[model samples]
Target: MQDKPVLKVVNLRKQYGSGCDHCDDGHEVTWEKNSCPECGTVYACNDVSFELYPGEILGVVGESGSGKSTMMKCLYFDNEVTSGEAYISSYNNGETNVFEESSQQLRHIRNTILGMIYQNPVLGLKMDFSSIGNIAEKMIAAGNRNVEYMENRSKALLKHVHIPISRIKDEPRKFSGGMQQRVQIAKALSNEPPILLLDEVTTGLDLSVQASVLDLIKTIRQELGISMIVVSHDLAVIRMLADRTIVMLDGKIIEQGLTDQILENPQHEYTQQLVYSLI
Candidate 1:
């Protein structure tokens, strides 16, 4: 039998500003209509939905402003959803929609059940804090109080991400961009979360650095069996990491299937253009 999905999202919507006159007429918002010409409402994400199965890597790919990151932000609770339901099977017996949970419950979920690595390391890491300290922050949030335990956990995670133990005391700002990203990964995995959300993790890195990060991600998934939602505009990155893929456009999922299937036989016009452009 198929395993139950670890996470499920239904009819998710996130919009900026009140509904406008044009939107009231049943006009769907496209990327070009981000700001409604009639009433100036911005549709950052509209009726987006997907599921993440246990130990599966789900890739979300789209151009900038396609609402890929917005969808992730909503999942991570960085952006509040206007309407919809998100259920994580491991949380509260999977009966509660996280969007409707209290702030304290959301905080608990973010700390213990979910781990996220932002596209910008600066957003995810404390640049001035020692690498170990950064990892310790997550541990502490997860209720770890023993100094020795926190230290060991941090060191082990750093080593797992291939950061040398000797460099554990150095601040993130002292490390290279790629190394900082690695440190972020270590911190994200410090608590052994069941689900990981990675948004444009390789966006601005050098080609070589991107490859290394991708390899590290693969290793983490293989070794830890963590389910991940990887968001990126680069099809190559998605191709490298995801087993299944979802194609988003103008705040909606336009196509989705096995990664190879979508790449080989794109059915949507937008997906066809996206795949062809990668050539």
Candidate 2:
């Protein structure tokens, strides 16, 4: 890891609904999971903090509703964060808080500094647009007006992700689940962002297709050296891709360490269950 982080997030919090005195102060009052029953407030993400170093993959692993996906959304600006500070080294030299930036600035950051690959193909890709067109759409947002350059870049990226050149002009709707995801990967890379955020990229694929996508991710990391934050509920995925791992439950991190260390000797009960289940 480098001395300076590529991305740093501090005390990120996202909560739905107003809080009551019962759970507002120190959360001392009784609650179920992450919800404060008294006030109907859901603490989807509670003071999450972490860093992504240059050329490394940091995995956030947890079950559904554990806030991992919420955190990813907050990072990508798809969902607003209630409170937090996110510093990107490539954005204003890491001195400015990204969460406080203007919407226009956020758009620039999203288009230039960050690329997000959503779990659902529909969320990350346009089903109606051709695969290359999807990639061109992102490039267009990044201010690329040269048609030839965009076309060349799109074809190259699609081919890199194993999409056939013959099918590059086909709409994603005609592709298989895995092929659609590959096209999504190509589109996300259209901007050449320094940071890539992947949320459950392999969640719904078949076992073999999942392996292919996972391998493509590894190849991207090795070849491009782009920093990545991968969110998944599966430890196996984290174990294969992440340099470091954080285990979350109930919207809070309960355990974290190097993937090997966490797998070999989990410290939390929930983490232990996750590790043992791999057997």
Candidate 3:
């Protein structure tokens, strides 16, 4: 009853193949639409809805094939939602349906309003560019057009992530997985976006490294007052970082509540299983 969220998603749905008779993206059909061909039109995301408030962390959890990543993609506008509305804006009450926005508007929203750290660092960073360069590129793309401002922001963000100043010129491939992840974090923050999307950020890190990264993320979020949606399979990771958590299974939100509540007394069977799995 406080107020509306900075980002709102309503009855969102993403279906694969219901249109275009030829293209693969148009259909959920497998192998030339032969065996179980009628099983086309798969729904990667089904009637999903959520809200993210400024300076809040929401953990999105689900098992494999639960469409967690797909949902993230839809929110990021990398993939279009088949139905429903998504609103993202600085004004808590301002609502602009994402699908209704033009490509340019969506681009502006993506660059300035939101930043995404992908699960795959290779996909997230430029392998050929130095870490600093990659970060700078993002800053520029985010509207920091001045060269000096871009470099300074890039350096600050890299240092903020605890990356050594000396390694600023090193390409992502030259760094360890943990280092690359940090660089990705830096790149994502380069734009000073108010919203951050992290997908399985701790996937490749060891326990100690994961702890360090998590701490760094928390520090940044507190300092920047950035809202976030953390997509992860690890409840411990989510517990350490998220204020609230939502459990998704087979493309539906099965349960949602504060971290302690969900961890202490998960209402749904699937949520209970997930909590128990961490034990």
Model 2 / residue 224 / CA error / Å: 0.5
Per-residue lDDT of candidate 3, residues 226-266 (tens digit): 99999999898889999999898867788988989999999
Worst 10 residues of 1 by lDDT: 24-33
The candidate that achieves the highest lDDT relative to the unseen native structure = 2
Whole-model Cα lDDT of every candidate shown, in order: 0.91, 0.93, 0.83
Q: Could you tell me the lDDT of residue 32 within candidate 1? A: 55
Q: Candidate 2 on 1-279: residue-level lDDT in tens?
A: 789999999999999998888877875777799999898899999999888899999999989999999999999999999998999999889999999999999988988899999999899998999999999999988888999999999999999999999999999999999999899889889888999999999998999999999999999999999999999999899999999999999989999889899999999999999999998
Ranked by lDDT, top first: 2, 1, 3
Root-mean-square deviation of each candidate, in angstroms? 1.6, 0.9, 4.5
Clashing residue pairs for model 3 = 17-26, 17-27
| Regions of candidate 3 where Cα sits further than 4 Å from its true position | 19-38, 91-93
Task: Please give each candidate's TM-score.
Answer: 0.96, 0.98, 0.90
Cα lDDT for residue 198, candidate 2: 96
What digit string (tens of lDDT, one per residue) describes model 1 on residues 1-279? 147899999999898888866674666645254566667777788888888998999999999999999998899898889999999999987889999999898888988999999998998999999999999999898888999999998998999888988899999999988999999999999888999999999988999999999999999999999999999999999999999999998788999999999999999999999999999
Error of 3 at 170 (Å): 0.8
- Which lDDT value does model 1 have at 143? 89
